[model samples]
Target chain A: MKKIKYILLATIIATIWGCKPEEFGPIVGSEENFLKEMQGTWSLTKVTQVDQNAVSNGWPYKQLDITNIYPYKELVVSFQGDASGKPSTFTITPGNSPKIADLNSGNWSVDNTKAPTVITLTNNGQTSTLTLGSYANLKNGKFYLKREKKVNGKTILVYQYEFTKK
Target chain B: MKKLILSIIFILSATLAFAQVTLSPATFTAEDEVTITLDVTGTPLAGTQDVYIWIFSNSDLPAEIIKKDGLTNGQWTNSADAAKMTKTGTNIFTFKFTGTTLFGQSPAELINFGFLAKTKDGTKQTQDYKPYKFDPLVFVPMQFRVFPSKMDQTDMTTVYFHQDLATDQNLQRMFDVKVNLVFYNDATPVPAVVATRTALVTVKESNILYSYSFIPERLITLTAGTKLTKFTYQFTGSVKDANGANVPVAGPVTEVVYTPFN
Candidate 1:
């Protein structure tokens, strides 16, 4: 009976050890935490492009300066208070060309249901996603989303919108 | 020697013919809509004879007018027909060429127009008219509409403007209009994004005032997180010369910064 009790204790210890602490800030790893933190308004200023394979091949991604490409300068976005990246919209006043409306209607979701999690934005029936890393590892004052695209004699503009919380 | 003497006499006659008419405002701006009075009343040319005026850039002069009896430059009229002087009154003729479009050149560029009285068949001819030179005025934005001259607690700074061609030059032809902005907290620019044209001034204009507003959030918060109180901005108007160099119509005009949440 004592041996069985020791075995039980050991099993409990192993199980507790197997579970890890939050990788981010207070109460990390919970999708709920990540979503809640994303609720406020964040201004998107920059978008960059990268070639992952080219990094090893000596060519890396470049940050695109689209400030002058106008029609749209910065995007002010707000997420819902809940874990759902929903009930959110972004405002952008255009500058030069490729005009985008002032308000872009969209729903958002974090796909942590699989490897290489992503946050997808759906607007006007079109969906765009950004790959996610450790949510807790997010640098204060800014957030980043990354993706991979194939170029078949076509252009692949990997947009990385640098955000500042408002 | 006889051929040389004939050539000299013909040249002299052509010079004499050129002196037959008086062109007022010998130098005019191409973009301006101005009236030019041409006095050929003193000349002996017949009323049936036409006075052809050919406008050309400085690059194209010593035209083929006398050589091939055709213009080496463009016509003054924005029409299929050439711009021929008309007898408005007596021997006095008038030639009014509207905006720079007639010369197919941008503002601030020089154009030369010469005149010669002759029929299309070279039947009745006058000497080549001395070249008339003009430098088109560099258009400037008539009035700048920097609204709210102050900012309210909004996410954007709004500006309105309407360029009237009748009162002002076409905004599109003017140089890029930039906004110089500096956000300050306590009368000091905490972080300088100086000489920033944060506001994208498109060439689009209308008789009715149009406007655009952008969030000054970045100009204030871009450097370090500082709560924005106010910002100072100015308007710098300019235009490009014939060589594409900026020619300032007016220096930068400073405007009072806006108050947020006011």
Candidate 2:
């Protein structure tokens, strides 16, 4: 009778643990949380597009004063160059041109396997198999954003951006 | 507990049921044109419906309908000749007055214009569309034009005044008119030691010309000793029209007093 009770208690604990929802770190990098985290303002600090050769080439990038990433049925990225920070919207597409896939709408997920962290973005009809990484330099400040991405076969890095907390 | 929940629900529902509408002026100017428009939309209705427009005098008189040309299926378009108001849509309407003369003088005036929406059953709705309530009072700038009919080398010249009337519409309201004469030497105008009244005439529709005359009262008063080289004057006055619109006029009217002083 003692053994049966112990077994029953162990089974109940295991069942509860299994049923409990998985927590993805403090940020909970789920699709909805990823969107919520990226909804505010973000400056382009570094952009890296990794080519097929696995070699990363950081382009000479000019960061706009501030960039705003907001959800409006689709992912909308806005930036302003002036001190007043008048913003204009831009669309992000994945891959090569002619057949450049739009990564504007749909769901997004983050993969934390790498050092910089990879963001997996998926849109309406297609998905980008490549992952993006945040800059490792600034970990203490609110300037947290995915500044680099693996594109084509190389890594492109964006070094600077103008962003304000919205 | 049920009553409390019911009251809370009623309050929330009432808060959500209220709607807001705003009206604005597209264009406004004293002389050339004035256009007013209303923007109406709310959660209570998806789209706008029938609307009625009316203009009332500030004196609480019965409002009048100033119709425009091109009316079809209840939509009205602005006319070319007269100031008019028209309904363009269930939520949008415009009142425009163009090419109206504003003579200087009189107290500031206000004209009240408004519109209302009606249901399909012809019942008045609850929205206030009075454009005149939000109407901005404008002060027409004064202008004066002075000219002499005759000029002699050494002879004294007299300045006469003319009448004023509303050129666009026939109305019988006149305002106090005043003209100041200043003699200028060379190209620059010289301030007069004393202001002489050129005319004190009332404006009448038949009398389009308000006349005033200025004669040299004494020869010794002339500083140039009848050898007046140049003479120019400015006129200023105020006018109030039948609609209680105040207009002001001010500016210089130039006339040659003499040929030249040797």
Best candidate, DockQ: 1
Task: Report the first chain's TM-score for all candidates.
Answer: 0.55, 0.31
lDDT digits (tens) for residues B74-136 of candidate 1: 333321245566667655555666435665555544455555554444445544565566643
Q: Write the per-residue lDDT of candidate 2 for residues A1-166, one digit (tens) a residue.
A: 9999999999999998889677767543444433333344443332222221112112121122211111111222332222222112223432221111235435544454223254445656466533333433222323343333322333322312222233
Which residue pairs of candidate 1 clash?
A24-A136, A48-A160, A70-A96, A71-A94, A71-A95, A71-A96, B30-B136, B151-B258, B153-B261
TM-scores of the candidates are: 0.28, 0.20
- For candidate 2, the TM-score is 0.20
The count of residue-pair clashes in candidate 2 stands at 49
Model 1, C-alpha of A20: deviation from truth (Å): 16
lDDT of each: 0.48, 0.35
